[model samples]
Structure formats: structure tokens, C-alpha cells
Target: MWMLVNANGYTLAPDGGNFSALVMDGGQIVAVGATDDVRLQYGARVDRVYDAQGATVLPGFVDSHLHLAWLGMQMNMLDLARATSAEDVLAQVRQRASTLPSGAWVLGANWDENRIANRRMPSIAQLDRAAGGRPVMLRRVCGHVVFGNRYAYEQAGLGIHPANPSDGHFGRTPSGDIDGYAYEGATTLLERGIPAMSGSELERSIAAAIDSALASGITGVHSEDVRHVGSLYRTMDIYHRLQAQGKRLRVHQLVGFDALEEYGEWLVEQANKQPTIEELDWLETGAVKLFADGSLGGRTAFLQHPYHDAPTTRGTAIYTQEELNHRVAQVRKFGLPVAIHAIGDGALEIVLDAIASVPAVAQRDRVIHAEVASEPLIRRMAALCDRMIVDVQPRFAASDLPWVEGRLGLQRMPYVCAWKSMLNAGLYLCGGSDAPVEPIQPLLGIHAAITRRLPGTSGDGRFMNEGLTPYEAVKLFTHGPSYAIHREDRKGTIQSGWMADLTIVDTDISNSQQLEMIPRTCVLQTIVGGEIVYDRLR
Candidate 1:
């Protein structure tokens, strides 16, 4: 029983038209038309009126992949994402350590070595000097690698040369000594020592992250937080509690692969109870999240060919083909889809093979971050697109495009971050931020999707042909998500009978030139399910 007027609305429907007004009742859109006509028709019954002030209104943005608790934790952790040199990182670590007690751990995240002046991770000795005996662990921007000081290793209950994980390794000196650098599975060695957040802390962190997301115009997120909270039960409990407390952020919770057994047990409990209608709308179980490989920036994404920049390595694979197949089968037994993180073509190939081997799981799988792929891989992926979803982080192009060509070579450049190609080949793509790794703003993702370049940069972007049109780019966060989650009939558009989830912004993004303004656009209001969850004016 509310109305929004003065909006430059992009219905994103068939024939693609604009409307100025919309009506909602009982959390569903009831009507949409010219502002005067709708206002005249519904004026008597409407209990509230929202003035958009001629701003643009589109479908609510949904982040297809992210870690909720971890993103919230990053809000309080040391931010090294902007550091430009090794010295800058060391200086920040020193400053953070100075504020903490002598033996307390100083944890930080999101430091990219490629952006540093030296183009290298700082040594353990350098970290030790900066930390001044305090335990310190700094995660690389990719989150697959971590560099720690001596005190950190000791505090983590590890010796100078702890056993390397079966799935990953520890960086070693020329003479074979541990170098305080852990990659892939080895990162758990350091993480196990970092104290776990209590239930209240986790709830606060999730709330803070949701506030940030809603402010950025995101109405929904498919979050993976089981590992961050240290227990699947705790993570699900917090989300359920938050929903009952009237939090508007819609969360599609993805259980981690390690917690598959727990998820199965939880499913039995769910079967015995009837969830309320509000609970169904606010929170729902998603697929089991699995990592097939690491990240491109960390040189750990399993590639078909060795890296051009670093010829000695072809990147690390978290699981062999046989193992991945086994895990997918296990998830199938629980009757849940699998969302596997596979960035490079090598990992994608293995994942495709695994899916192809399991006939029952073929179209039900989700490939997260297919950042690098060849023609054959795309074709293979398209074959399963009947129900399969490819979850992509559009913002990654803005950050990774500058150096991805160097990691991969000119020959592979055409296939890297090729979104348009995938779309043209009939693949269903859903956009995300991978926040704490990238910013959570959906507009930033839209900007990157259209420009294929950094926000302020000019000229043709790298692989400009691979870029999507403004409307197509916007769809990645809008209709794309609804399609991915099988809610197209009720969400993703502003038509009557659809769910009333709308993102109102300051920019009218209808064409290519207007895309430049997206990076600077401010979200005026975020309305989810007929409720104004975030309003800048208020």
C-alpha cells in the first residue's frame, strides 16, 4: 500500500520501456505506469508515497557471492589494499601493532603485491621487524596466500618448519627453511590460532556488513559464512535470528564443503519444521560452496598452461579431478547443488569433467569465478547452462585487467574476463563483489562491466569488445540474479506481481555514455519487499 513516484524506471522487461511510478501492496508490486495516472488511480488507497525526485529506479542489486562475516570483520581489520609499497605495508603493520598489547595478534587483509613498488611479498624477517614481537598475519588481496611474522607462527602453535598441507605448501628459503608464507590449504595453519568470534560478535559483524550492503543498494546476497563463524550451526542460527529480528537484507546462505555432514543433519531438522513465510523470504539455504582452486592474483588458480609472468608454476589445485568428482557426488547425496570456485581453465575443466561424470548433478551445479576460460571450456559450460549458473565478480575486471595480461599472455588475453563472450555463448551469469577482496558496491561492478576498465581511466579498455552494453551490464546485478536463483517470475523486474525490491540511484543509466556516471552515482534509497530499509534522505 505504498507508491513511488518521479522515478526514471527501467522496467528491464520485454521491449524494454520506462515508467515513472510504481505501486506495491503486501510486498508485491501491484501496478506501474506514468506518475500522474498511477497516482490518480491509487491515490485513495495508498498509505505512503515515496518521491524518487527524478532519480533512476532499477531492480534491486543482488551480490551472487560473498563472505558476510568476513566482510564485516574487514571493516575493523587493518586495510592494506591501498598500500603502494613494501615499506608502506610494514609501516601500517608497525602502527597497528603499536596500538595492541605486546603479545596480541595484529591481523590484516587485502594487500596486493602487484600494486606494490617492489612487486613482491615482504619477507618474514621484515614482518618480524615491523610487528616488534607481536603476532602478525597479513593476507594477500587474493585471500589464498598469507605472510606472517615469526611471532605469528609461534602463536599459531607451529614451528619454523611445520608440515606442509597435503593440498598446499609453505614458501621456503633456498636452503629449505619455512618463510612464514602459507598458500591455499596451508592458510588454515595461521587461521586456527586467530581467535574465533563469539555468537554476538558474529551477529554484529553480519549486521554491519548488511548495513553497508543496503547503503550500496544491495537488497540480497548469497553469502558463504560457515567457515568464518567456525560452525555451520552458528552461522545459520545468526542468520535466522537476524531475520526474526526484522533485518531486511535477504541472505541466501551457502554452506561450506567441509560442513557437508552438518548440512545434511540440519536438513533433517528443516524437514520436521515449517518455516514461516517471512523466514523463507529473508533467508534460505543455497548450494554447498567448494573451492577447486585459488585465485589468479595469488598465482594459485589452476591454469591449463604455466603462467607467462612466472613460468615455473601452473598454479595450485585444491583437489585432484577424482577428489572433486567424489565431493560433488557427496553433495548430490544430500540433494543440494554445488557451487565450486574454479577460476582458471584447468580447474574449470576438472569441474566440467566432474559435472559431466555425475549425470544427476549436471545442470544443478554452479561455477563460481570462471575468470579464465578457453573456447572449448565455454562451449562445455554452455552445454550445462540449462540450470547451471556462472557466478562472476564484474569488479574483478577493473582491478585485475591491468595485470592479468601479464600473468596470462597476449594469446590468452582474449579469453580472460570475457563476459560478453560467455553471455553470447548462452551461459547464465550472475554478478557479485567478492567484498573485502573487492568493494561491495554494485554500481562499481556495473561500471566495470560496461567500461572493462578502471573508473577514471579513458580510452578503449583492455578487451573492450568483451565489455557488455549498459543495459546488459546492469542486468548482471538485476535480472541475472533472479534467473540464477530461479525467482524470475517474482523478482528482477518492476512489472506488476513482481516482488517490490527496487534500487533507486542518482544516475539515469540508459546508454553507454551514461555509464561513466555510474561509478559516482549515489544510492538515494534501497527498498526491499515494500520496506525502505535504507534511505539517505532520512
Candidate 2:
């Protein structure tokens, strides 16, 4: 039994109220009220009393989207996320290749051409020169495109005139020669040649990612790791083993579409049994994650019209509408909802139409990254509020606002990352970092939601009318996530019988000044199930 007192707290309960103290026992919030009242009832039996010193306390923040295994591996890769120019990226590659053994593959990630000085991708020759005879492959920030040197293609069994794969194409110069860039499915061709990590190495990376998330005050995450871990059983077994070490992050594991066969076998193995409350508290199966299209940054988001900047193409769709419909039906047989990634209007329309065709798939269906939309599409989605949830990355507005208007036209400005409009239309929104694509800090996401401006900038925030209030923005990581995972009754609040997951910050977020400085707000403690997982004070 433990008690937390002298705190400014928001319960976020059904009735909507506040509390000054919380009493927790056996991983549940047993009592919450005034400090005097709570102390009078449970102070005698409490084993410890934590003083918050009047800091703000709220439900633990949860990331509704992210790739755990990928983020872990990216942490160790050559980080080019902050490279300023094409030359800067090549310089880093050159530095990385110098330390590697001869012929070793030099890997890097997160290079954004939009942010670079020349606003261009490094050429194959530049990469070849930088790598100094070693093979090299670097992923764009969006993860939809990759740049490689000639050595990499040759090592992957592709000759100079290698044909494009059926699912995707390699970038070609005006003369129809390979340009060392791979789109979507073409990335698999190069990836197959890279060495796989051993089980111990993979587990270490997963553990590091989880600990990093916990340090950021993220007590839980909806993570997709089956594909990265290589199998459904391995993904589950890894999480189960991690939980045994006390104070682990809660994970809602999503199975990838590629693992459906293994998922079916695993489902049948446990068809007759029921999961215990403890089993759900640590880890549970989420929905099937399927990519409907690529990313906006790569101009492969399957837009309804050609991109304003690139008038030649409307972008690519990984699956045609008919294919997506069939896949959804296949997933329905397992009795689980589907979380579809639809970033552009074209992809969103196809996803919506597919769901409308099958009402069963609509129930608890999640539309991930519904980034581009028109008024009509918003209205159509509003009608399905009872059966759907839109998982959005709030920081996207902060990161994409500068170039979004150019990619989409000025006419499409109002519809770009219209989060406030979505909320007003009665749509349920869950927030996420989409880490490695964006930073995994919830406060940065909240700040982005409220400001809608790039960090360290001055002037009216872009699309100011579409910004959320402090409280509403906070809910994106709190109440909204609990509802998305179907654990609203047990996790989203600090009420009696609710899980004892609390995040303590040094500032009261209700204050506009404090909220505006959210990115600088210090997290004093992060507690999950009544156990302190992170303590800066300690």
C-alpha cells in the first residue's frame, strides 16, 4: 500500500474532477480525494508516503503508434536525422564507413531532403565515393524510400540493369538508368542481403527501446514488432520475458499482415482459454497493422490528385482497393480489428470504402495517419465515430507544416493536419510519436498539438484555428489511448479500481505559460501499477 499526497492532480474520470491525494494498493488506485480524507482512511496502513511538493500528476502517457523493434535498431545506426545537406549526409557516411571492416554494409537512416541545404538526395556516385568501396544503404526519414550505392545493389544480386520488382520500382534517370534509389517494396531487395541480429542482440535492442520510452514518461505503447522480430511467437515471448524483470513498460503488440499464418496458428493454440487480468496488464494482442500506402514526405502517400510540387504523379498505393478488401476479410476471420495506415486522401478513401463494405471490420477499426482529408471525408468519418478511432501523430504538423502546403496546394492547407477540426467533428483521436520518424517525447507532441508550429519559431502558429486547448491536447496521450486499446474502464483515469499508472510533472499544465513551455517541463516521476519505473528525483 502506498499514498501520494500534496499534489495537483487531474483524474480525467467520467464525472470530471480533481484530487489532492491518491492511495494505491495491489496495482490499483484504491482511494482518491482530498489529502486529509485519504490520509485519514489509509495513512495508518500505508507502507510509504510520497510527497509531490504540489507538482501536477496525471494518468501515464501512452504512445498509440510506433515500431518498437525498428526504433531499437535505429538507435544504433548512423544517425543522419540532423544532417544539413547532401554533402553533410555523405560526410557522415564516409565517417561511418571508415570504422567498418572491408566490404561491410554501412547502414544509416533519417535523411530528409526537404531539410537539407541543397534540398536534394545524394547521388549514387556521391554515396559510392563516400563509402570508399564498401556497400551502403540509407533510409529516408519517412521510411518509404532508400538510397544505396552501386556496391549495395551488386551485393544484393542486382546487376546495373536490374528490373523493377512487381510491387515497386527503382528510381531511374531520364536515360532509364538505375539511380540508386528504391521505393517501397524495392527496399526488400537490398534488406535481404543485410545480416540479421542474433536473438540476444535483438532482445537487448528491444529492452533498450522500452527503457528509453519509460524514461520519457511513456508507461505504455501500442508497438508493432512481429515483422522486425521475425515471428509472432518470438515477439510475444520477448515481451513476456521482459515483464519478468520488475517495472516494465506495458505493450499492446500488433501483428503484421505478413505474420497472419503464424498468428492463426497462435490464435488456435489459445482458442479455448481466457487471458487473466495480469496477462493483459503487461502485454496483449492489439490489432492487425496493414500499410495502405507510403508516406507524405516521400510523395508516395496515394493522393487523389497529383502533388503540387510533383505534378507528374499522384503517388503509389501498396495495395489496390480490391486487394485491401480481401486482406481485411482474411483478418476478420481471426476476430480482430484492423489498423490501416492511410496518409493521403486517395488511400483514405479506399480504406474507408473497404471498411464500409464490411461492417464487421469497422468495429474498433483504426485509421492510422489520416493526415490528408477534405470536408466531405471528415464528415464521412464522423458518421463512423462509434466504430472507429483515428490515430494521429501530433508532431507531424510541427515537422511537415513548412513543406506540406507546397506538396498539397494552398487550397488544401486547411485540411492538412486538421486535428481540432477532427475533434469538433466528434472523432476520437489518439496521439503517437511514430518514433525514429519523429521523437518519442509526449510533451513535444502536446506542444506541437497546442502550438502547431516548428520548435524555436515565432509568429502565429500555422493553422492556429486547428490547434487544441491544453486539456484537449493532453487527452490525446491519456484518455484517448486507453479507449483505443479497449482498456478505458481500467486504465485512463485515477479513480478507484483503475490501474495505478501516474505521470508526475514539475509544472501545472493548466497554466497557459506553463503549458506553452511544455517541451521544457521536467518529468519528476513515472509510476506504473503503483511501482516507480523512473524517478528523476532519486
Candidate 3:
């Protein structure tokens, strides 16, 4: 019942023919053609009209990976994502601590030490000073390490000294007293003690996250939030409620292994009854996630070779090949899409071998990071594209660059962020922000992809050989992701049969000149299913 006209938008074709108008009715695109052509058919019945005002219009972005509940929790908690030094982080903690009652837990994340002057984590004594006798649980930028204050240790019932336990370690003082840093499973001590969000609180977090995503022009996200929030059933119930209440953002939920183990029978029943994706829907849950290894920054990623910087240790592998293969087979048999974290080449090979052990399926089993993919793996993955995909974060260049060559060294540098290589290898390359890890802005990721360098910095990129064109980068967010989720038929483009999930930007993003300033180009409006979900102009 609406028409959008006079936009400098493309139909997303190879030639990208100029289009002047679009028609929408019943929350779907009815027609797209010249202004007169669209009006000739629906002129009399159209209830409202909108003008693009000469801005660029494209498909709404899809973040192939991210954590929503964590994003929402960060919104409610203190944010030290921008802290550049240990003192700066302590200062932020001290400020937040002053407002809280004594013994309250201070929670936040996105703490990157690379930006710090000395690039060192703050000590427990410093955190104690900043936290004012309160418990503090701050996740590192990588999410693999958790920093806690003395009160956190006290609350966990561990005395002044705690040793390495289970699959993780705690940094201890020379005298054997517990330090702030906890790694891998050891961080669970702090997390397990934190209170879970109430039902109402979870709803609020989901709503806040949806609004934020819409404002960023993200119509869809593949979210892994079960462990970050609570039970899978509870989260799904909340999503259903939000959908019934008319939430617009599309959600592709990633079920945790724990959730599958706990509620396998119930989930199987629900999957059978899940609605078809013939039309654009608000929420769907049919994906399973497994962690193959830790993170590059955390130095726990399972590398085939020892890290150049840390040659003494290779890293952690959460599951053996047999174990991972068994889990993959189980999920595949249950008709669930699976995505495994594989940052290092060692982890990538394991996932590939496991998937290759079984016949190919169209479920789009994926290697989530594959950051350190090798030539052989690339070739094999290309041969397996009919069954698998690679979901990568372009903005990782911003964080990993300047040091990637140090950790990965020269031989592996070419393979890192080799999106074009992935494409050439016949792999579908979807992009994401990995928000809370990287900023959730689609433009930021695009800028990183097209430039492979931080904004405002010099040169084509640190790795100019690895850069992707602006159009190709955009497609990673649109076409690539759509294909990965089996919605390429209707979700990723601006065609007559496609859903009317469109994003309007203030500038022409495809222009190479604009790539330099793309991060500054704001989302003028985000339309989902022909309804305006976010409108800066309004």
C-alpha cells in the first residue's frame, strides 16, 4: 500500500540497471520499475508514498554472526570498549562502582589491551582500587579471558589463592595468590556466580537489541545468545512473544550444544512445526553452534604451527576430532544447521574433516571464523560449497591487523582475510560485525573490507592485496548471508519477488571514493517487510 520513488538504487544486478520506483503491498514488494510503470499498476490503491530523496537504497544488512543478549547486557552495564589504557579502564570501573551499592558486581566487555599504551592487563590490586571492594567481572575483548576483582574471588568462596582448575587457568601472584585474569573454563567460576536475567528483563534486553539493530540498518542477525542469557526455550518463547507483538528484525537463533542436550526432544518437535521461510518472518530457530577452539587474541586458538609470538604454546582445542565429528553428525541427522568456531588452521581442518566424513547436505554447515585457512582447506571447502559456508567478520582487520603478520607471520598473512580467495575457491563468504567484539555498524565492516585498514589511516590498506571492492563487500552482507541461510530466493536483493527489507543510506556506497567515508554515511531509514522500522528523518 506504499510506493518509494526517485531513488538512485540498483536492482542488484550485474549491470545494476537504474531503477526509479518500487511498489509494496501486504508487507511484500509488489513491483519495481520506472516511476510511471509502478504507478500505472497501483496508482489508485496506494495509501501512502515515500521519496528516497536521491540517497542510495540497498538490501538491509544481515550480520551473519553476533551475540544479542550480551549486546543488551552491555547496554545496561558499564562499557569499556573504548578504554585505551589500563588506567582508563580502571577509571571507568571506579566511576561505575561509585554509583553502585557495596559488594555489587560490575560487568562489562570489549576491553582490548592492544590499544592500551603498555598493552598489559590491569592487575587485581588496581581493579580493587577501581571497584571499591565490589565484585567485578569484565570480559576481555576476545571473550575468552575474564578479569575479576578481589571481591569476585571472595564471592566465589575461593580463598586468597586459587590454582589452575579444569580446562582453564587463573593468573596467580608470585606468592600463589589469585590474580585477576581467568582463562577458558576458569572464567566460569565468575560467570556461574552472576545472577541470571529475569523473564521481564530478558524481554527488555531483546527489545532493546532489536531496536538497536534496526537503527543500524540490520534487518537480520544470526544470534548466539543462549549461554549469554539463559535457557533456549525461554529465549525462544520470548522471541515468539516479541514477534507476535510485531518485532520487525529477523532473527536466526543459534542453539547451544548444552541447550540441545538439555531439550533435544522438545526442540526436535518444535523444529518440525517451525514455519516455512517462504515469506520474511521475524524469528526462526534451526541452527546449532559448537566451539572448536578459543580466540586468536586469547592465544587459545588451536594453531597447526605454534604462534610466532608465543612459540612455547600452540593453544587449546575444545574437542578431539572424533568428538567434533560425532557432534556434527548428530546435528546433521537432526536436520539442524551447524556453525563451529574455527579460528586456527588446526581447528579448521578438524571441522572440514568432520563434515567431509558425511555426505554433503544443503543445510549450510559452516566454519564460523576460519581465520587461518590454508590452501588445501580452501580448495576442499570450495569443493564442498554445496554443503558448507564461511561466515567471517571483515572488521577483524581493524583489530588483527598491524599484529596479524606477527602472530600468523608472512606465510599465513595472505590467507588471513582473503575473502576474494575464499570466493575464488568457490566458497560463499558471508560477513558479520561480531558485535560487542567489533562494532555492529555494517558500514564499519564494509570500510574494513574495502580498505582493510582503519578509517582515517593512510594507504589502500595494510594488506592492499587482500582488499575487496566496495560492491563485493556489500554483497557479503547481503547476497552471501542470504545464500548461507537459504533465503537467497527472496531476502538479499531488491527484485519484484524479493521481500521489501531495504536500507537507505545517505550516500552512494558503491563508489570507491565513498569507501573512504562510508563509515560516516548514516542509515537514513531501515524498512522491513515494507514497514519503516527505523527512520532518522522521522
Reference-based lDDT, each prediction: 0.87, 0.87, 0.82
Model 2: worst 10 consecutive residues (lDDT sum) = 354-363
TM-scores for every candidate against the unseen true structure: 0.97, 0.98, 0.95
Tens-digit lDDT string for candidate 1 (268-335): 98778978755666787868898999998889999999999999999998999999999989888887
Q: Model 1 TM-score?
A: 0.97
Overall local distance difference test of candidate 1: 0.87
* Tens-digit per-residue lDDT, 1-538, candidate 3: 8999888886675545668889887768888888888888888889988988788888888999998887877788767777888888888888888999987788878787777778887888999888989889989878888888888888887657776675677878888788788887788776776767798898888888888899999988889988876788788788878877877888888888778775577666666777566432567665689888888888888899999888987788878899988988887776677888888889888888888887656668888978888788899889888888899999988668777787767877877877777887778889998887888888899899888888888776766767888878999888878888788887788888688899899989989866777989999999888889899988
Model 3 TM-score, 2 decimals: 0.95
Looking at model 3, residue 335 earns an lDDT score of: 67
C-alpha lDDT of residue 3 in model 3: 94
TM-score (C-alpha, index-matched) for candidate 2 = 0.98
Over 4 Å off, model 2:
361-363
Task: Return the lDDT, model 2, position 135.
Answer: 91
